[model samples]
Target: MAHDHQHNHLVQMLDLDAEVLEDFHRELVGWAGSLVGDRPRVVDLGAGTGTGTLALARHLPGAQLTAVDVDDEMLEHLRHRAADAGLQDRIRTVRADLDGDWPALGPADLVWASASMHHLADPARTLARIRDTLRPGGAFMITELDGFPRFLPDPGLEDRCAAEMDRLRREGGMHMHENWGARLTAAGFDLAGERTFELEIPAPLPPAARRYAQVTFARMRERLADRLSADDLAALDDAAATAAHRDDLTVRATRMVWVGRRPS
Candidate 1:
């Protein structure tokens, strides 16, 4: 959650380019503007490091943005990011767990969750909550990984990942949800859409990129260490080391953007 090299680099390696993310927010703003007719309030859930938050602040002028995340350190970095971007006044950072009561945030015109929905214990319920937070006809958007796209080219690695994650979930007593599209529909979104991007990261990963991966893997292990068996932990470490050895590591993480309007 902190702006360690690994965290930031993994984002750069796996997530879309800032320009692409900016373009997306612009498109979403236009869509929301068509309904609300002007700059509208938006809430960015789990706005770690405030990259998206900064982008939204720049793109959505005259907009009130609340960047909500539970991590204080992440929020601290986000605050500086906002200040550096000269958006200190426009973006508000709130520390709260999404599983609990949301902060008195807003009748937001748009609620955007990027790569954060998967972390929610109940994604459908989270969608429903996001829907409730919106004004009438306001939009709730979720961006998630599409699954291992490049895994198809690699031999058994994709399957191995899928199996490992599944095993990890089962061993941890965690119910990991894969189908966000169906979940959104179940949460009362009629007009739903999804998109996939290859996100071809270059080989011999950039130092920042590699750091991101390492930090993320370490973070994940920290979260699961208590739940995982010793063998499981060792297996995960082995897999990570093996993954790091390859010349070209193509991670096929798709960004699924699902926007649903609350029924007016």
Candidate 2:
């Protein structure tokens, strides 16, 4: 039983069963697969709803995953999800504040910090801590958006919306951009190259994916209602309305993955 706020956010990005994250899971697992051992011990920071955890379970089969989040409700749901996937014994959850000192995490083989890294009070420090938590030769990966998805068809609408979104996120104490490779280096991890996942689901996306996109845009519009101009807002509404009806919609985003490894 998740609290309303936690429940709503998770529902926005994931379906009741975490099925909507299949593509998300695939992208992440694909990048980490070569690095993870058959029985690797892994930790996911900011493991919201455990979407990535579920991905790891399916891919690594034998991976021991520790999912840490500040929200107990999310962790609770993650537990249920793992059980449903018949992976309960392989997944563990920790309620934690990633900004403060980390909890008893790992000598883990892999550290997966997705959209959560930039949310940290000091991302560089956290990255360093992540390195220390990993076993020698352990791997680290941070997946974050370069920007929001471009949904508005109108010229300039995407820019205005993205700018405002940045303001709102900064106000929420989130840092939306960082040279993560540099941060990882500063944190004492050796760089292992990076990749950008261009997420474009040709439309008539499965019902869940479509719903996820709809929720994403709707939430954006709501967040920017106060900051966006009437004209811009109206344009956004038009885009949203059009998106809702059409199957040829373009749900596009760039997710950058920075990989690193602690010296063995």
Candidate 3:
């Protein structure tokens, strides 16, 4: 919806699945519980719609929160969400790009990015900044996609879908995935813990799924329309719909959570 690319598709798809939001909140709050003592400091990057930020605020009553995002409209939504959660005082929304120089607000106890790092042009540099902003022994958490799901009834469809995404990335300058843990280690973050979760989204694909498919196809078609036959586009859409209809969807979208420390 925002960037009009593969990463955007993944974001829209996750938006379709409300469960992902709840899980992210659960994870963030669980993490905040570990660091929050007497009024903790937390920073959320790429805080679109403020779902994660507001959720974390609900859990960390005494937290001094800063939510940063490039899109003002999304940040507005986050503001409303924070207000709705009665956390207007505890939360402050900052309109700043994560890829740029961060404003002078730091010494955070927790820095979290959910499904946002891959969108950065230079994630390594950003993570290093995040690490430096943290207080001693502070935590840096990043969640990244392992890959798209393979819930297609046809076995080859999954491979074809993956190939299409790969092609689009190479031709369209799309950033679909990343290994933030490796980047964190390179940025001098000690790996404290890690977890992986596989989610099989329930489908019969609703309008939300269709919307996501159309957005993704438009991105691919934008670059490869000359090379991609009309039939190929049709087949991809059909496969997406088919995958959405499956009982379990059996999608293999894996989310990796990496926890690192600033070393007290």
Strongest candidate by lDDT: 2
For TM-score, the strongest prediction is 2
Error of 2 at 18 (Å): 7.3
Model 2 lDDT, residue 98, Cα: 86
lDDT of candidate 2 over 1-264, digit per residue (tens): 334643575455644224654666586787797897789999999888888888887889888999999988778888998999999999989998888767888899999987888788877678778988999999998888866566434438788778888888888888778888888888888999787777666656676655666666666677777898899778767766666566666566778898999998
Clashing pairs in 2: none
Tens digit of per-residue lDDT, candidate 1, span 66-138:
9999888778888987898889998899999998877787688888887677666766677878877888878
Compute each candidate's TM-score over C-alphas: 0.71, 0.88, 0.77
Give the clash total for candidate 3: 1
Over 4 Å off, model 1: 1-37, 146-162, 169-176, 202-207, 210-247
lDDT of each: 0.64, 0.78, 0.68
Off by over 4 Å in 2: 1-7, 14-24, 203-206, 234-238
- Model 3 C-alpha lDDT per residue in residues 1-264, reported as the tens digit of each score: 435464555445545443433564586568656755768788988877766687778777778889988888677767876787778999998998777778966999888787777778776677778888999888877776654545544566446556766776656554555666677788898988777777554555455544544444444444445555677767765645553334433333577888888988
Model 1, residue 191: distance off in Å is 2.1
